[model samples]
Target chain A: MSSNFRLQITNLLIGMCRGTPGLTAELRELGYREQWITSGFPRDVAGRSHPVMVLASRETRHSLFVEVAPGPRIDSDRLLQYTGTTAVELRRGTNLSREQTETYGIAVFGLTEHRDTLRESIEESGVRAALLLCDAEGIRLDVNPFMQAALANIFRPLLPISWAGVPRWIPFDHESGPADIAAAVVPDVVARLLAGETRIDIAEVCREQVLWKLTTEAGKKRLRASVRGALAEAAGREMRKYFSVRGRFVEAATTSSDDGVPLEHRILRIVSRRQVQLLTRLGGDDRNAEDR
Target chain B: MIARSRHHLHDYLQGRMTGTSAGGTAEQPPPGDTEPIKTYLVEVRGNGVAGRDPDFSVVKTLRALVSEPYLKAGFPARVHPARERGLVTIEGRYRGGTPVSMYADCRDPRHWLIHTLAPGRTADWAIGRMAAVGTRLSRVSMPGQLLEKLAGLGLLEGLILSHDRRQFDEGGGYGAEGFMSMQLWGGQSGRILSMMSRERSLSDSVSLSRVHVRYWPDEDDRAASCLAEIDRDGRMVTRGTSYEGHLHLVKVFRRLYTRQIENLESHFRVRADGDAGKLVGRCLTIRPARPIGNSARFCDIAFSGTPPFRLWGVPAQTSGSFTRVRALDLDVGGALDCEVTPEFLRVFLLSGTSANSVVRFLTNLQHYFHSGVRLLDQDGQDVLEL
Candidate 1:
């Protein structure tokens, strides 16, 4: 999702958590583990609680949401320190600054990208797969990829935890499964794809229902070369764009005349192989052989 | 000889083997022709390729039948010389110690498909399907019994046994998915079923004794975990008020000074630009609280309960002249200042062991410093130190 949309939703969630009883109860029912910090230096938000949580909700298909509520109010410097698009820090000194009394905490947020398949989600989530702690909102709060992964495993069995307790007075009868796919195994298929792997079949990977989201908007997204540990044009272009266009760096790169064009597979193929001879020793050797 | 490639069904209709016709002509039979009589057979061929193993092919074909309502072009009904392919993997020792692989080539056709399509056998397979469709089917079935002998109808039956030990869906039977698993219970039951579905493909079937079927989703035999029943041992708790108790003034006041001595000294020096080492000497003091547990009635925090804090004469002291005592920024609101600082008192806290640092912090604070400072992590243990 775009940065703007991500910010709007995150703020909305935080506000709802604080103000709306129904939402808070729902979140708590969905297993939101919010730590209690009643007071701090000047205000509660400023002690920098960073209301962080790793949540997963099987609301639709299955979604994993990781939200780190950065300080509700923070200095510009702190915001810059954690400026990752996925890692957003709240800015301070708004109209609520007076009510906050210069004390506010910012929560950082990171959502695990779409796993789409149930089978894969059961296995891995990149932020330290073992420690991939997910909360109710399908949000994962694993800055450390290793920890995220470890936690993912520890919580895999927990995904199916339901609060509907069976009392002795009740007689039980129920159906086998939902009409639609309710839950799936983890180490989700999309995660495998990002980690340089193919799917069971194109048909399985691309289901009839649901939409596919691109990792980024600007370039050719799926880098087969990158997928297989080869040079990916998109990665280079993205890195180049990140450094040059964003940085104002002199990285011997040029924005193509073809702006507004999404990266295509053909272009990626060309870029992955575009300048091998000039950039590598192997390329130099091949060029020398050609010259000879 | 006619062919029916998936691309175009009519293109391969050579001479139209139209049985519902006016007794075999050029034009294919209309859908209406077989409305009541049901002339066509309904034999479920397990394999699509030649020489396919009858075991899984039969079961998988049954599963597909229940998986959908009608057959599509690629997976069709009634074809000649069945095209089921069975897989084989043989491992044998080679010269290099690596296993060599080879496959057994079979050119024979499956009996289930071709045998049922005999020219005279019309409506034979359909009646069998109609009968089996609604019964509980066990994968471990007697093949001859499975295909009830319809002497007058004249259709061939195969030994279709179910591999699944659990619920199997032969559409609907006594124990089959179609019959038994219509809807699931909610909350705990939902959780269990959802979890089961993820790991296994479950189904049910009717049985002679207990209905059974083959090719059910993997059955996850989950051994339920032992649940813990908790007993709240301590029903005693207080809120919104300070716990009051009597204590020796020295125990309360003396300890308050010593605990704050090191930190207070450092803050004094950092803000004052003074010799900090001479100011904040590690010191110890003692305070008591209402007793509980086998704990020494209190615990230590500042020295990490390790470098064991022990003291006698003075909690802390500097032998230098009292000529200059400078104050910097008010420490968490002058926590260092008290009636004890005539000789620059090094504050220390003597604590009886309480497991709760929060309780210990406040209890020790009441005796020593007479203030509640949330700066310390409930133990009066400073964050910067950790």
Candidate 2:
């Protein structure tokens, strides 16, 4: 299979933009204009050529090399190693985090870049090994505690999940009421995940909670009861976007409008028969562990 | 230079302060004495790297105690190996030409106990110096819950708590911060927690930064008591204590601290070798009261190197709210890859990484992210349990 190739742009960097699918929009928001320059094919240290897009940031006067590897495939080891070294060199020279250290800590964007018009429609059912990402609004299907669980499900779903995790108590921020502190920790989150307990109960956590400096005053009973009611309602409302809840326990939610499969089940069936053929021909590496 | 025994060390300090080596009871203070002698207990967590065993050698630990970081952070001192085994003297002069001397017993490989009889201001300064040294060496960190348990051991004298809900999300600008400190003499000490909780603003976000408790060494003898104030980061100031009383307090403090650190290490130890399909054994799930991912501060606080802790590569942020980066721990030169989300952060141990890095990450997260963040063990239990 022969394809048209561009010239190699050796100094065009790669680590600067690895996991950002919406780089163009993000750069614009950060006050940087992206201008694509016609460059040579990106060559690794070993001289193997790959597709590369070189964009110069107009405001910062710095160049960003984005590698849009098709089919979400991992590049060669030599090229991957080169990117690692380049990232190190950039961080050592100056500080980067302080500049972006406020407001929204980091924005979680989702996949499916078909906001406008699409040339080739990527079929959800046909495609295998999809990336599980997060979003702000709409149905929010989040895989917390362990983001790697999604990866593990995608690559090797049949393998038994042997690990468990400790309980984490998260305190809710109350805008009103007394100053006493109340926190909730979802018990058996890891065990539920391991056992594939899709319908999780988040109510017990809110009801049976750790409270500090709480007084059992007869007059304050109504206030205490109201606070507990508000907490349960808030938790259910916040989690409803991710799952289907009947009262306290939560059931799995479907992926999208067209597909009826649960997100968790869909993730497990990522690598299908059609995708296996494509993967074999392309010699895909098992670097699925590296999410970026 | 070094005092051979505990008694010898006390006498050495006595001579330095009094200028006379009289056989007096170093275990009790003189009556009507406005200037009461006290011992400052400084716990230094050892950096267990291969060759630089700071805990084993007095000279090595002293070298670390007076490193450049300490010097820059107001701990300008000269370290000399003491004559006693596992003992070193850190000597420095205050701005007013007041000479301060501290004898650090490095006998314990894990926790180095520093026995010093200095004035109040000098003692506080020395403790500040130890904190500076911890920035390069190892900082003693304990969860607020454990500190509360320790506070329960004796009558509460004082408590200092500071918490900021806006630090992690305010986009580098100031947000809602609450600081409540109380120094009570008798009755107020017991009800301080409840009294402070009355301030609805503090809520559950409060972190116990420092706690002062007065415990009697001999319960029968009321006069034989010490008011010990311990900071969350492992610095302690014990006033009105003899050399024996200080040692007795240190022993108890050491036991609790060791247990706390050990449990933390076991829980946060991220290893590459795990059974197939298992979630990484343990992870820090931070539920920030407010939503994260709006500002860039999260990356800086998580990736940017702070003094001794270094990161090899720049932390890469996905257009989506995610960060995948490798952190180079300068303490042990170990590398670990970390993935950051708006809610959770986990470290992947690469090579030569130590549990110290995990401890540092949790300790800093409290100050930078959320003080109420809980670290979960493999079995889904809180590791901060006393």
Candidate 3:
């Protein structure tokens, strides 16, 4: 996926998490309170600067710094500092020193390759968690996916509330509905997590609702039809407004309803009202001027 | 009968010569009508990198475009070159009627000025020809095609285009009139915003509009002004001038920008490397004025570098007595008292002023200072001296 797409998805996730009460409650239960999610912070802290996405504590006590699309090899040290932790262990590469890891009290998890390690570390640390979420299919560029079994096993216990399976590329038809989906699924995922469900599958819910499909082809026709309907409705509204104004002008020209007032005066009254409205809308300072 | 006819012919000849006819009706004189010649001035300034080559090339191209074989055959024309001054003169008449002349001056490589004089329909035809030439030259992707096009339309000229990467570079200011579109990156957005605010505070004459900004997703705080429009499309659409139009312009710009941010593009591509240091500043011509001080009115005072040295704010001093000195604060930080006398204006650059800061100060001085004022280097030469 392109960087812009990733950014949009990240923003969507943050907006969903911030807006949902149930999700916030679930996060508070997990001890991740005072959530501060941002694309990148302006200032550097602990000798580290802007991270791709960060969800930090209010007082910088604990945080989750997410790198959505990881490169070939992760910069574990930088990642750790961004999370305000002294040390972190990656499943594929070097692990943090035991003393340092114990002192920092935070474990970093890469969802793709380090899923098994992350699960073990989470159980061992029993403190706070930072996660790197990616696709399991690895169909998108710059996204690394772990094996399905590994993801299921790791997430089964944690029961994390996620915006996964919403489609990496959102169709134009679904533009108006993403926020709505986010609002709905965020609370649902939180409920599932609280219930200790084996899986919290948003994609399954989307599939059932016919909002999306596991196979891209099944959703194409519906998406196109929805987009077409929206455009037609917008165009129809514009035409109606245009014709209505034209009809009013025609009626005003033909009718002699006003009591002996000249046509010029009647026309001026209508025009003057419109002019006043325009001036008011534009914040003209001459508000006290007579309409005539 | 032959003698009578000869006498009549003689009478007719005498009538024609003396403004009278055989039947005693005075002969009507040919129409005595004179049309004024319209003059258009075009000044071209290069983007420092292209040097004078672009300006010279444009003039040469214009001459070639106008002096096509068909045009010469259709109209009485003469084309000549002054190799010494690198100028070309084209004098011609349209369909053997109205006289027209074009003088392209390429004496200064950094600056080229083209002057055209023609009467009525001929003037219109010449301008049209120049526009056609500009359109053809625009395809080459050379620096100065936009300026040339503006010149063709008889718009304002002498606009400096700078994409200079250096922090304290020269040539950064808006012209009295010109068009510029730039994609500012990283911290430059902050600088532009500050400049815009400063310009807003300083003068109401300057107008900036059609601005679009996009924040970096990874660094949301660090936004980029991605799209700026100032007649870059060569549409000749004038910017908003009336107060209502200004309000509307601002509103439209804000609404469009917000919409763009909400619906981001599918793919994000950074500006191309080759486009680095592209021309990004406005070009302005200096109007002439009488000398302020006791010095010779036309003496050349050369400063070491090019004009418009990235100065911020207008020059504070005006022509008057020195007793009532104006205390001025520099944009780069620091205050100085300025003394403006009829003979000369003296500026005191306080201690701890950096060279670059001084250059910036001088740039503004060149622009906003008295028209007669010229900055001289250590050698007593004009700053803009070749």
Which candidate number maximizes lDDT?
Answer: 2
DockQ, candidate 1, vs. native dimer: 0.01
| Model 3: CAPRI class | incorrect
Off by over 4 Å in 1: A1-212, A218-225, A230-292, B1-161, B164-386
> Which ten residues in a row are the worst by lDDT in model 2 chain A?
A1-10
Instruction: Supply DockQ values for each candidate.
Output: 0.01, 0.02, 0.01
Candidate 1 chain A lDDT trough over 10 residues, lowest sum: A165-174
lDDT of 2 by residue, A209-273 (tens): 22111211221343344444443342344323333445555454445623334432123223122
Candidate 3 structure quality by residue, lDDT tens digits, B1-386: 01123244335333433455668788653221122212232222222235455435655655665676666555555656644344566667778765556554444432233334344466546544543321221110111222222222221312322232121212443442322224444435434534643563332211222122221222343321111122211111122112222223223432332232222111111111111211111111122233334221111111111223221111111111221121212122222222333443333332222222333343333333321334332223333331
Give all candidates' CA lDDT scores: 0.22, 0.42, 0.30
Question: What 10-residue stretch in candidate 3 chain B is worst by lDDT?
Answer: B265-274
Mind giving the per-residue lDDT tens digits that candidate 1 earns over A65-145?
A: 233322222233323322221211111311112222222223334234432231133223222122222233334434333
Largest TM-score belongs to which candidate?
Answer: 2
In candidate 3, position B116 carries an lDDT of 41
All models, RMSD in angstroms: 33.7, 24.4, 27.0
